[model samples]
Target chain A: MFKDAWLVASKDLRIERRSRVLTNQLLPFTLVILIIFAFTFDTHPNLLVTLSPGLFWVASLFAMTIALQRSFSLEAENQARDGLLLYGLESAGIFLGKVVAIVIQSAIVELFIGFGIVILYAAPLHEVVFLALSAFTATIGISCVGVVFGAMVTGRSRDSLLPLLIFPVVAPVLLSATKAWEDYVRGKVSLGDPWLGLLVVFAIAFGAVGVLTFGSILEE
Target chain B: MKSDRAVQGLGLVAVLAIVATYILGLWITPPAAVMGNLVRLLYIHPPVAWVAYLAYGVTSVASILYLWKRTRDPRWDLIAASSAEIGVVFTALTLLTGSIWGRPTWGVWWTWDARLTTTALLFLLYVGYLALRRATPDVTQRSKRSAVAALIAFIDVPIVHQSVVWWKTLHQSATVFNASLSPKVHGEMAWTLLLGFIAFSLAYVWMLIRRYQIAVLISKRQEILLQGALDERMSTV
Candidate 1:
């Protein structure tokens, strides 16, 4: 399973590396979302700073949707989704693989958005370790569940449908990650643990859901 | 759809029981010491909220049955879908009635209290579930898709339950009528609350069976249509 997961992950990354979609399109889109928030706040640095944790997750989640859509669209074309199953690749592996690819893509966008918030929103990142850990767990939850729903709407209007399907599913990530970061920044570092624990549970729960259900989803 | 006698009986009972609940709630039961007339909304609000949760619970259970290989009957999918459709309605009513209850009690139509926030999120999550159902055209595909989605959306159920416990809440905590087995609310109010629970649960069961019947009929029609299309293409060939 691990070997299959690595193969699938590498295949997606290789395609992404050559196509430059993640770097050229999705990354810029996330940065744009951050800037849009800055403008929406009327360039009030203080308000932006206060609201930055929520704005960051909201923006990253938007970008996560685009990245997921791109990830699945890569499979949708050329009947590649069927091809993945035809290769006798483990369905769980394919699920984990897609999850890894999405996680990396989303995290990069998250990283740039982290930079964008600092430079544009004037929000200080006081605890780097906590922010990154929260992002890591939160993005895992988003990607695993995102992958499930992403593959789901591919037969229809995926671009629009994916967000509606996933935003509500991944809402816990949005809520917990934002709160964890908010507390961390307020210097209540220990208070972040409970939110972090919630994120992990969300991640593990959906992660299991993805692996168990992906086979049947692919068969369909 | 032949109207099942049992279902008809259930519908009559549900209506009569709900009427009893309403009459008792609105007129028979005296107003609270503090809340006065405002307390009447409690009868409908809690029961409606209970049905909403119960509806989702039914959906999740039916989904599990559908997903389980040995027991993967088509009826399970139908039940899951039917329950969720009404579950969304019940959830909407939950929010509406809660909003009405809030205006007099909390002085706001809505607040970001933990319970309210989680409930709102659950409402949207199931709405998305229904949208997902509409998006997929294949029956088997739709079944699998929605099954997975249903289970995922159900993750919030526990959180919503615990939200008040975990966080500071504008929504009232379970004081008299809480999870504890002890009773603080008594007399007509208690009996009416009990009737409301039974009435709503019965109503949910009745609506579920009716909706499932409708869905079965639709799927049957769909199969016939597919057959007709296939027959036409073959005749042309």
Candidate 2:
């Protein structure tokens, strides 16, 4: 099972290496989201304190949702999911592989957009290290759930509906993570701690459930 | 199963429950000192919210059961659909009474308080679930999709429940369930609330049995129609 899981994960990584479509999609999309935020919201330093975290997560989430929703597209579309099933690989292996790849994929975008938000919005990064830690924890939470939600809703004619279904339930993470980000930007170092705790909790809960449920959902 | 009998029984019970709730709520319960006649809205409002949440829970549990066995049991699907429909009705009642209660007490018809906002969003989410099921044509696909959707949507319930603690809002926390109720409220108002809860739970069960039967009838009709169509197509071919 461990070997199969690693192989599945590496398969996705190899596809990305060869095509680079997902990474390509994330870079431009996240950059544009930031640009739109900069142009749209008042970029005053105080406003930055107010909006920085929200802008970062919202952007990262949108870009990452697109990436996550597409996580299974390659396997699902060409009947490759059946191939994977036929390999006698553990279903949980498949879920773990996809989720790990999604986390890695979204992490890249999150790091870029997260730092860029600080630079563009002129947010004080006195706790830049803490902000990154908080954001990373929150990213894992969102990506963990997003992986399952994305696959669960896959194969629908209307693909965009995945986020509509996911965003509301996952909004707490985004909302809390952004709150922590705002506090970190504002130099209220202590305030970010609780939100950080919530983020980690959210990530672990979803990841654990997703792992357990993935096999059942994948069963034919 | 003699479903028609269940429906008839459900209708009878629903009428009786409504009458009982109204009588207990209006005449039996005492008026509030602070809110006056407007406090009567509590009898209807809380029951509706309670039933709505209960219905959503039913749907969530049913969805899990359906997915667990892949039984494609019509009864399970019926329970899910019926509970969701009944839930929507109660949610609407909750919103309407809440708004009415708000007008008299808060001097506004609506407030962006956490509870109110969360309750309103809950209505939208379930309504969307119903619509999603309606839009899909394939029964299997509908079953699978709505099952997942129900599970995902139920996650919002806890957040809605905790919105009071999570955010700063004007909405008061659980009045009946709160720790610090005055003796006056505890003696009289608590009894009224207990009666209200009982009445609503009965109404929910009655409605579920009725709606469950209706759903079964519809699915049965659908199966017959599909069979007839297939037979015609085969004969022509």
Candidate 3:
């Protein structure tokens, strides 16, 4: 299972590297979103700093949507999904592999976005460890969910249905990550806060759910 | 025909009971010591919200049954879809009535309070469920996709609610209904409130039955149309 998962993940990442889609298109798209938020709130530096965490995640979600579309279309556009199924990989492994690929891509993009937030919005980053930890777990939950729904909406209304289906289901991530990061930036980190626990729960719950159901969706 | 009669019967009783509850709620029962007339909505809002939760519960259970190979049935899919449709309507009413109740009470038409935010997300999640079903035109694929979607939404809702509740309690307002009106036990208000629950439950049952029947009819129509199209193609060949 682990071998199969690695095989799939490496295949996806290799495709991403070969095509340069993530860097060439998605990164600039995210940068534009960050700049747009700065333009939206042009007044107080303090307010912009406070709102930075939320604006950053919001932009991430939009970017995540396009990236997800690209991720699934990598399969659907060329019958790659059919080939993968015929390769006898376990569906759970496929799910995990897709999640890993998206997570890695998102992580790199987010690091850049984080810097963009701090620099452009003049946001403070006092609690680096806390912020990084929350973001790691939160991105796992987001990617786990994104991969699941990304596969589900592979066919019909492929453009619009993906985001509408995903954004609502992963809303807890948005709320917790934003609050935890907001607190972290203000140096309000604490031991065993509920937000971190919530993020982990979301990650595991969706991880299990995606594994159990992805086979059915893939067969469909 | 008999089931149709039964649904009509259930709907009539629901309407009559709701009318009685409203009459008792609006005039028969004395107004509360604090909220006065605003308290009457307590009978309306909670019951509608309760039905919303109940409808989603039914949807989740039906989806689970459909997903499980041992219990999979097309009828379960229909039930899941119908209950979700009803759940969306009740969720909408719940938010509307809650907003109406909150405006005069909370000094704002809307607030980012825990329950309100959670319920709003619930509305969006189910609306997405319905949208997902609409996107998938295939029958079996639709069933599988929506069943998974429904269960995922169910699992996420409590986590969403808990996160919001903790966020509010830790820093923001602890609870939205801190000045909540408790139902007086063994009084006319309590009975009317209880009646509100019964009326809405009955209404939900009636709606579910009607929605399920409509779904059955539509499926039958689709099958006939598909057969007709296939026959024409074959005859041409």
Candidate 4:
């Protein structure tokens, strides 16, 4: 299972590297969202700084949608999904591999968005470690949920459906991640710990669910 | 035809129960000392909310049955889909009635209160489930994907509720719209609430049967149409 996972992950990452889709498209899209938020709330810098945590996660949420779309779109061509099923690849491995690839891609966009939030909103860069850890765990939860829905919506032309499906479901992730970041930024580390813990719990629980259910989804 | 008669009988009983509930709730029950006449909405609101949760619970269980290899059946898929449709309607009513109930009670139509937020999220999640069903063109694929989605979304409900409750507590805003069952149910009001639950549950049964029948009929029609098309092509060839 681990070997199959690595093979799948490497294939996806190699495709992503060669295509440069993340750098050329999704990264800039997230930055643009950051810029738009900066302008939308340009009334005062202080307000922007206070709201940066939410804005950062909202941008990450949007980027997660695109990353999920790209992940499944890679399988849309030439019966690739059929090949995976027929070739005897472990469904759990494929599920984890896809999740890992999406997490990596989302993390890159999240890091850029984090930097953009700092530069654009003038948020103080004090809780670097807390922010990074919170963001990493939250991204895992987001990716796990996103990949499951992404696979579910494959071969369907309803582009709007993915976000509509994912946004409400992942509300807890957004709520916790945003609150954790807010607490960290406001220097209330103790308050943020529970939310961070919630993020980790969500990530693991959803990842396990994905591993258990992906085989059914893939075969069906 | 037999099942149709049963559904009709159930529908009639549901209608009668609902009407009885309305009369009891509006006139027979004494006005609440606390909420006054506004307590009338309670009969409708709580029952609708009950139906919503009940319907979703049915969907989730049916989905599990459909997904399990040993017990997989097309009827479970139909049950899941039909129950989900009913669930969405009840959820919408729950939100609407909750909002209406809140206007006078909470002094606002809506707040980020835990139950209300969780219910809204539940509504959206199932809306997505229905949309997923519509988006997938294949029957088997649709059933499988939707069943899985149903289970995932169902599992998320408690987590969403818990998180929202925690978030509310952390913020320490006094929630005006308390969702706990009133500990002080007395006399006719209790009877009326009971009637409301019974009426709604019967209504859910009637609706699920009708919706499931329609779904079966539609699929049968599609099969016939596909057969006709294939026959025509074969004749031409």
Candidate 5:
């Protein structure tokens, strides 16, 4: 079942590779958002330290929302959602595949944004390890909730409302992850301690809930 | 007739309880040493929040039941939808009163503290739930879709509650359950909160039942009208 799910997910990736929609179009928009932010804010070290985490995470989340919403569209538009259902693959497996694709897409966007921040705002390289860990956990937390929500609310108007609804419940993950990153960059080791625990708890809890609930949600 | 009587009785009980809570909270409850009359705001605020959480809980349970039974029962969806709106109201009230209370206590109308921020987010989530309902046209599909949202949304309830403890924020520590309050309960304030809690729960039950009835009647009428249209088309053909 898991292997079949991986095949279904790879099909999505292969399609994206052929089309290059995410690469040619979405990547540029992400770069544009990051560049716009960098020039708009002050370049002072203290101010950059304060703004960096929020800028990176918010930009990455927005970019990922656009990506995930589009990821399911080809299937949904062609009634492939029905076909996927007919394939008898576990809904959780389907969800995990989409989530994996989303995390990778988001990680790419984060790397671009991180590079932009370092270039424009002069972020130190030492904190890249902590930033990577924070980004990895936060991406999983965000994608876990987003995939289910995107599937559930697919055909509704005001589709933009998906992120608004999700960002709040999943906020602690973002808050802790970003805070930890900021603390690491600022060399505040003490404050970063509990934030690691917070991120882990969010990822585990929401991932479990999202996976358990995905099957019920996938039923028409 | 029995259900009607239940609704009427619950309505009266809700009214009486609200009046009792108001009287005790406004006049009988002593002013706080630090916040003076602002402390009274606590009575109205927390119960509204508690009831909001209660409403969301019911919505979640009802949603899962609707999906599990494959009933698409109008009553279940109606209950889920109604409580979501009511939950939004109570959550809004909580945010408003908390802000009003904050101005004097925290010296800011809004601060990005854990509780206040998370409560604000809960408010956003349900507002989106309400909006999603309005957008979808089909009854079964709407219920199904909203049920998914409701279940996903319930996950946030615990997170919202514990956000303050999880992060350093301007919101104060929970006083009632924590060590901050004395072992002896302050009788008048406690009584006021209890009354308010009871009244709010009664109000939710009364309001939900009323909303459910209306939704069932409307949908039934629509179904009948749709069937008639189909019949007319067939006869003409």
Candidate 6:
């Protein structure tokens, strides 16, 4: 399963590298969101600093949607889905592969947004270890659930439906991640543990769910 | 058809029970020490919220049945879909009635109170679940995807409640609805509340059975239509 997952992940990454969509399109899109947010907040460094944790997650969440859509759309073209299925790849592998690819893309965007927040919002960089851990666990949770819903909504004409379906369900992740980031950035290490624990639990629960259920979704 | 008759009978009983509860709650029950006549809304509000939770619970269980390999059945999918539709309606009612209850008591139509926030999120999640059902055109595919989605969405209910409770405690604001959780109501108020639960449960059964039958009929109609289309194409060839 791990080997199959790596193969699929590498294939997706190779396709992404060749197309440069993530770098050229999505990264700039995320930066544009950060800029828009800065402008919306009137670029008051103090206010921006206060709201930066939420803004960071909001940007990552939006970018996560686009990343999920791109990953699935890669298969939607040229009957590639049938190719994947006919090749006798395990659905778990396909699911993990897609999830890994999304995690990587989302993590990069998240890191770039982190830097953007530091520069644009003047957020302190003291809690580097906590921030990275929060982002890592949150990204895994988002990608696990996101890929399932992404595939669920594939071939549908209603473009906004995926976000609608995913956002409310993922509210806890947003809530916990934001709270943890806020506590960490405020230099209160103890206050961050519960939120961080919530993130880890979410990631593990959904990860198992995705693996068990992906084969059923693929068969359908 | 027999069950349809039974459902109609149950519907009549539900209406009567609801009417009784309303009358007793509004006129027979004395004003409370704190809330006064505004407590009347309590009967309908809690009952409606109960049905909403009950409906979603049914959906979740039915979804599990649909997904399990040994127990997969089309009826389970229909039950899940029907329960969800009813669940959404009741959830909307829960929000509206909750707001009405809040207005006089809390001096605001809405607040970020734990119960209210959690219930609102629950409504949106299931609304998404229903929308998902509409998006998938294939029956088998729709069943599989929605069942899984239903289970995922159900996981949020407890978490949302717990998180909101924690959030509320951290902020230390007085909760709007926690008073009702105490088993303190006595006399007519307590009886009426019990009647309210019974009435709503009956109503849920009636609506569920009716909706499930409608779903079965719709699927049958779709099958016949497909058969007719295939027959026409074959004749043309």
lDDT of 2 by residue, B211-231 (tens): 786788898999999999999
Highest-scoring model, TM-score: 1
Model 3 residue A199 lDDT score = 88
Give the candidate number with the greatest DockQ: 4
Q: What is the lDDT for B139 in model 5? A: 84
| Model 2 lDDT per residue over A1-220, tens place | 6677788888987887678876677688888888888877875646754777777788888887777766777777778877887899887788778877877787788878867866877765678788878878887788777777665654564365666656766777887888887777777787338888899899889888788877756653
| Pairs of colliding residues, candidate 4 | none
Q: Compose the digit string of candidate 3's lDDT tens values, residues A50-153.
A: 78889888988888788888889889977889889999999999999999998888888888899998898888777877888898899999999999998888
Evaluate all candidate structures by whole-model CA lDDT and list the values in order: 0.88, 0.77, 0.85, 0.85, 0.79, 0.86
Q: To one decimal place, how large is model 3's interface RMSD in Å?
A: 1.2
Tens-place lDDT digits, model 4, residues B17-130: 999999999999998998899989989987887788789899999999998889999899999999999999998998899789888977888888666677788999999999
As a whole number from 0 to 100, the lDDT of residue B109 in candidate 4 is 89
iRMS of every model, one decimal? 1.1, 3.1, 1.2, 1.1, 1.9, 1.1
Please give each candidate's TM-score.
0.94, 0.83, 0.92, 0.93, 0.87, 0.93
Error of 1 at B38 (Å): 0.3
Give the lowest summed-lDDT range of ten residues in model 3 chain B: B169-178
RMSD per prediction, one decimal? 2.1, 3.8, 3.2, 3.0, 3.3, 2.8
Pick the winner on DockQ between candidates 2 and 6. Answer: 6
User: Between the candidate structures 4 and 6, which one is better when assessed by DockQ?
Assistant: 4
Model 4, residue B161: C-alpha shift (Å): 7.3
TM-score of candidate 1 relative to the true fold = 0.94
Q: What is the C-alpha DockQ of each candidate?
A: 0.74, 0.18, 0.71, 0.78, 0.53, 0.72
Candidate 1 local lDDT, A1-220, one digit each (tens): 8888999999998999999998899888887787788788856549999998999999898888888888998999999999988999999999999999889888888999999989987788998988899899999999998898887886757787889888877777789899999988898786338999999998998899889878888887
Second chain TM-score for model 2: 0.89
Arrange candidates by lDDT, highest first: which order?
1, 6, 4, 3, 5, 2
Per-residue lDDT of A16 in model 1? 92
Clashes per candidate (backbone, < 3 Å): 0, 0, 0, 0, 0, 0
Flag the better candidate by TM-score, 1 or 2.
1
Superposition error at B229 for model 4 (Å): 1.6
- The sequence of per-residue lDDT tens digits that candidate 5 reaches over residues A57-163 is 88888888787777777667778877887888888888888888888778887888888778876767465677688779878888888887777676645357677
